[model samples]
Target: MPFVQEALDGIEFARGDPNSTWGSVRAAMGHPEPFTLKYVAIGNEDCWKPHYRENYLKFYAAIRKAYPDIKMISNCDGSNAQLDHPADMYDFHIYQNANTVFSMANTFDRTSRVGPKAFVSEYAVTGDDAGRGSLLAALAEAAFLIGLEKNSDIVEMASYAPLFVNTNDRRWNPDAIVFDSSQAYGTPSYWMQHFFSDSNGATLLKSTLQANSSNSLEASAILFQNPMDKGNYMRIKVVNFGSSPVDLKIVIDGFDRKLLDSSGSKTVLSSTNVKDENSFANPEKVVAQVSPVKSLVEKTGTNMDLVLLPHSLTCFDVLMKSDITQITADDDSHVSSM
Candidate 1:
């Protein structure tokens, strides 16, 4: 208990005012500004251990009293069940096979909206399917992330585990970035993160995949503004986990009849083979390819047919002519805009 208190005190001092006790020490070390530390976890993956709840309560009470504004995270997963203890948020971790991880995109679909939000602090596609970071693993993780985007209300945060690994001594396999003393390169999983870079504050648009028989398709749409050009764009990200190609028809409802311009781009993150990986010798083997979308023009009510590649993650970025600040759903059926 003493040790935990001391640790908490130090953390508080680090983020405290420069006039405070430990903040003075930090200032004397040449830095005066406090670090932005808002979230803290009681313990990592220790909810099932003996006496974890007892010790956790003590720590929680102390922290709650000292720093009430800081969001405390509990290790217990409250996704499927309500937590007995109090927490601002709960930690959720998953390390599973490709198929399972892909299907788990809807893992939080049925979670209660009244409880603490979930912090998926750790997640990855592991085992033989994710051998040293393969395209297959990246595709599955992308699909899962699309699910998270659809359920972002309940999921406060999510991240890929084992971010960087040294090539010389790889204690953990399938890391996102691989590094050596001289050079560095990103795996397919690392490049996959680029697909969601614009999703932080973007507005999620309603999207649906009307397939007859295939259950291997997952997709989501978002409306985001380009920081550079200051133009609004609609990005439709889709992941096809099966081997068969899909001819998907994208219909944008509640959109202007001639709003879409011909100047649009399509970005795809895929490779020739599913299990293909990137090494120092061939870093660009499995990377995202950007191309112009020639088919999209001043279409009528935004009706377009898209061919999704098998086992690939594709993003169709269509530039919007006007800024869409708000959208209301139709009464009869929920309409999705591409």
Candidate 2:
């Protein structure tokens, strides 16, 4: 009974009728306790449907009374029904080209009101395998992710929709992550997710680049303090959109170079020629490779400069010095406690 109660505590169920006898069946299914469901979506992409408004209202009223605390989300676009019902979260879908994705980020940043935080539940570039699954798309996805991280406080939650695509039974053109039936492989966009999720840091530091051309690269540095330990580190993600390699002069105004001793740099290059992706046969064909640190120079009162490859993703980790005076002072304070 305790296990059943725990399972039902936060479970959201989908059904048409609230007074329907199915509630008992849900409880009977190894969970005799009623689940404290919070949000329930009426339907997916209901704006295009014919009977969406009527059916949605029916379900909305019934579910509202059945569980008054449950928050309802109507899956409708900007329409009369959405304005009328006014659910907790309004679902919206956006499928656009690479350029459009960039524009959307700027729009979100400027927009004053998009009541019910906009959830970019579905979005991706479209076209044949050449365009949809191209390196350009991957780069666009990375840029969009940067915008998302910058605006996480406003955006509630976002997911790359239609996650899987079977090359055999193809339905969608481009997906953030894709795979085939026989072999499951990730697209270049997939790498963007892995890189972002794995390397997201706690503090976002301001970064800018001085370049001669508009194609030159720039990025914001993210500082992450290890949650489990006191280990502190930094990730410098450089987005180079230039047609030619730009010589980058890196500088951390506040941090010291002793921190970068153990941390190494990794590059994810999606060169125009290297757009080939992984298949069942060739899994590691187009993955990111560790580029040797060409030249690293550290000095006082100067920026660190290095030549970055043209049109590439470069990440650098700068490890924090454990023996810094402040760190040592804190350690001394803890030692006194012992």
Candidate 3:
């Protein structure tokens, strides 16, 4: 009980007012403002242990009484079942092979929405398929992220695990970023994350796909404002996790086709082989390539056809008119391959 109390006390010092005891100590160290600490997990993946629930209750009660606004996270996974105890969010972790990771994109589709929101704190494509961050692993993870984006209402947060690995201590099988004493480079998984960078606060658009190879494809569309240029753009992200190429025809509706700028962009992350990986010697071997939409697609209006490469992740950004920032999408947009 004392240990738990002390931990909560530490949190109060970190985020509480400067007049508080712990806050006073922090202020005395030349930092007067409180830190932004809003969420705290009771423990890491300790839900199965016998004493986890008992100790969790103590910590939960103490923190709730002290800080009602702080979101408390439980170690238990509430995706498949409801948790017996109360929590603002529940932990969900997954580390599997490429196929399993990709197929698990719909893992939360049918989850009970009455329980606490899910926090996917740790997830990665591991084993032989993810040899030191291969492109195959990244493609599967991208598909999984697309699913999460589609289910954003039930999922509160999600993050990739093993973010950085030092070559000196090569313990983990695959990581997003690899570094050493001096040089550092991002793996395919790291590049994969850039496709979703504009997702925060973005409005998701209704999108559907009808194709023979739909099983090997995952996609989502969103409208977001670029913080730098203050430009409103619609991004359609797709992941093809198969060997054959796909000719996809995108038909966007609900907005003025004339409003879309012809100078859009298409970014793709792929290589000659699906299992290709990036290393210090060849960091750019599997990096994403950015090109003008006109260079890749014949047309840039509401209807366009794109040839998606195998085991690739593609993002198409269509710039909207400067005056328009918020607009609802119609239900007629569909993904089809001709």
Best by lDDT: 3
| List of clashing residue pairs for candidate 1 | none
- The lDDT-based order of candidates, best leading, equals 3, 1, 2
TM-score per model over all chains: 0.93, 0.69, 0.91
Q: At residue 163, what lDDT does model 3 achieve?
A: 93
What lDDT score goes with residue 199 in model 3?
81
Off-target runs (Cα >4 Å) in candidate 2 are 1-39, 46-87, 113-115, 129-132, 176-182, 199-201, 214-218, 225-230, 249-262, 272-274, 291-306, 322-338
lDDT of candidate 2 over 286-336, digit per residue (tens): 566666442352442225565666666677655565533343221111110
CA RMSD of each candidate after superposition: 2.9, 8.3, 3.8
User: Which residue runs does candidate 1 get wrong by more than 4 Å?
Assistant: 297-301, 326-338
Best by TM-score: 1
| lDDT: worst 10-residue window of model 2 | 329-338
| Root-mean-square deviation of candidate 2 | 8.3
- Residue 208, candidate 2: C-alpha displacement in angstroms: 2.6
Q: How many backbone clashes does candidate 3 have?
A: 0
State the TM-score for model 3. 0.91
